[model samples]
Target: MLSLHANVYAHPEGAATGPRRELRGLPLPTLVGPGGGPPPFLQVLPVTFEQMQAALAELPRCDCEPDGFFLLTGHTPEGVFWRLNGHMQEYQPEDADGPSMHRIELNGECPVASLDAVLRTIGWPKAQLAFELVREGVTLIEADFREYASQPATEGEPRRPDRGASRVPAPCRGRDDAALGTSALEANASYTPWHITFGTYGTRLHGDRRPTVDLEHNEYGTPYLPRNELRRRRAEDTLTGPPVHLSAEQRRLIERLLPEICHRGGWRIHTAAAQSDHVHVICDVRSEVHGEKVRRLIKRWLSEALNEKWPDPNRLRWWAVQGSNKAIKDESYLQNAIAYVEKQRTASR
Candidate 1:
């Protein structure tokens, strides 16, 4: 069972349920992660001014005041983020400008977690890319209405990142879509796009397929038809066989090998779980290939792994021909995904 502890960080909406939680004035917990972790101590690092400005500018654009306080979670190029052990206090900008010359530390009071250790966990070479600035259950990207005030290119680097540059992609969203809680592929987008496909051969099909993650009223508010389409389709199907069920051993093998496949493909597997008929993996895909291609690549890998172990030449179709691939654009969306997949895995066990 998961522990029942209050999340010190934002719930991925980037805000709290009712009260606006602030770590700025409060004292932090004594311990960090599992076991005896880094004592919240002061750790300093270098940051480019342009980088810092681009990062902080999200505050005002989102209508958040620049109080110099927010959760600075480090997102790995893998598309996952870990909270800093401590809070960042206020720091005055240098009267004169230069490159990579700023490290903000809180009052001598609270110690911070080791960012180096966090980076090591994610293995992203660039520390700056991991900066996911969230305040009040909101990511700063929403406020990115315009580019940061144009700045002089420094150290021969472009004032802004180049195309396909590894940075937190801003929310190119409208309030209507946000109100609808649309999928990231439709709205809140990061550079890493995930295209999940559901194959129909080996799973139960409904008469009417609905666009939803779980319940009818999902974050995206997707709707499905009322009629039973699966039954009708089954009656007419001529080529595909019934849904394929994975054995306990097969599921375990997939859970283990699936991540390795994603990693080798330059993707980061954040949340992965498998069941008898299907598998769910939440990852930050690095490839620019079409989502269908991604789905096929994964299915092929799974087939190879399963066939290598079980060797069933007669078995042709594994996954359904269609599945939903959600774009994890927001922290809350990601949280919901992790919970949805992990929760079922726990229940089945």
Candidate 2:
């Protein structure tokens, strides 16, 4: 049995009862597999960010491996919500006084059936319950299952007015068809261009010298080191030699090498520019190809070509570990990326 808790909210459309009762450590029967083996029991914990962090902190450090999975569900007014599916891998407290953060590795499949059971237990009618997976989180794989129990269905056959199921309209299939597009090319299109920018070792920028960005909560949630603090740290941590800046010959070499490398790697280089301290490239890659890998490959090829030409005995690091890898979602974005890379000097000035 899996014990779960929930803080129920009033349904926007109003429920048969005023509002569903809050579940408090409610024990749910474990599912049995076809082979009569005990299937994995998942606890659906609908929590706020603060609550989730608190729950994670309360967990005691144990040598025993995780036996169950947890589904973290949360909502925002701006049509943003998260349905994170993962088991606690490790827990470590920031300090003796602070709360602990659990490092969770995301699982590919979320137990929708289990979630349905949870909703059913909470008295939400099956007909009213609807969810769609949305890809918006920083962890490219992490997605939200946006629930729409209150909304009316937009597509498919009309429901009978007399039926109990009719009280709660069918799930609204919002822009699934339109967003995916109709044609085969549109469906499997890899038209998204990548805007890659990498700096030479030891250059300060908007987001450098900070704690690594949490891929799960990439934008707002992550803490970044202040620019002044970064500059101070850089000043304090001086190197034996000067910072690695690209020479005129090196920049020229990069310009000559990028197109050939892109062609060989089955990528289309729309625009590329090599600067004294950094490099930028706007390239079209396959739909499945990761932008990070593309940037790494560009840096690797450039570094190798440069190393062969000007073999430095000191073995200096050519490129910084961090770089920008933005995807151009549309034609306008692609054009903008191309222009940005092409006129890199003018933009910098």
Candidate that would win on TM-score: 2
* Overall local distance difference test of candidate 1: 0.39
Best by lDDT: 2
TM-score (C-alpha) between model 1 and the true structure: 0.39
- What tens-digit string does per-residue lDDT give for candidate 1 at 1-349? 0001011211122221222222233222222222322111221234433444345444311111122222223334555433322222222233424323122321111112233322222222332221222221111111120111011112332222222222111111101111222222323333454535353353545553533232232223355435566654763474334458777777778778877777555555676777776677777753343344355557656865775577443454465544566566678777777778776452257
Q: How many clashing pairs per prediction, in order?
A: 27, 0
lDDT of 2: 0.44
Q: What lDDT does the true structure give each of the candidates?
A: 0.39, 0.44
Residues 212-300, model 2: lDDT tens digits:
32233223334544446665565447532346888777887787788887765666779788888888788777767666666756775
lDDT of 1 at 21: 20
Q: Model 1 residue 139 lDDT? A: 17
Q: Would you estimate the TM-scores of all the predictions?
A: 0.39, 0.40
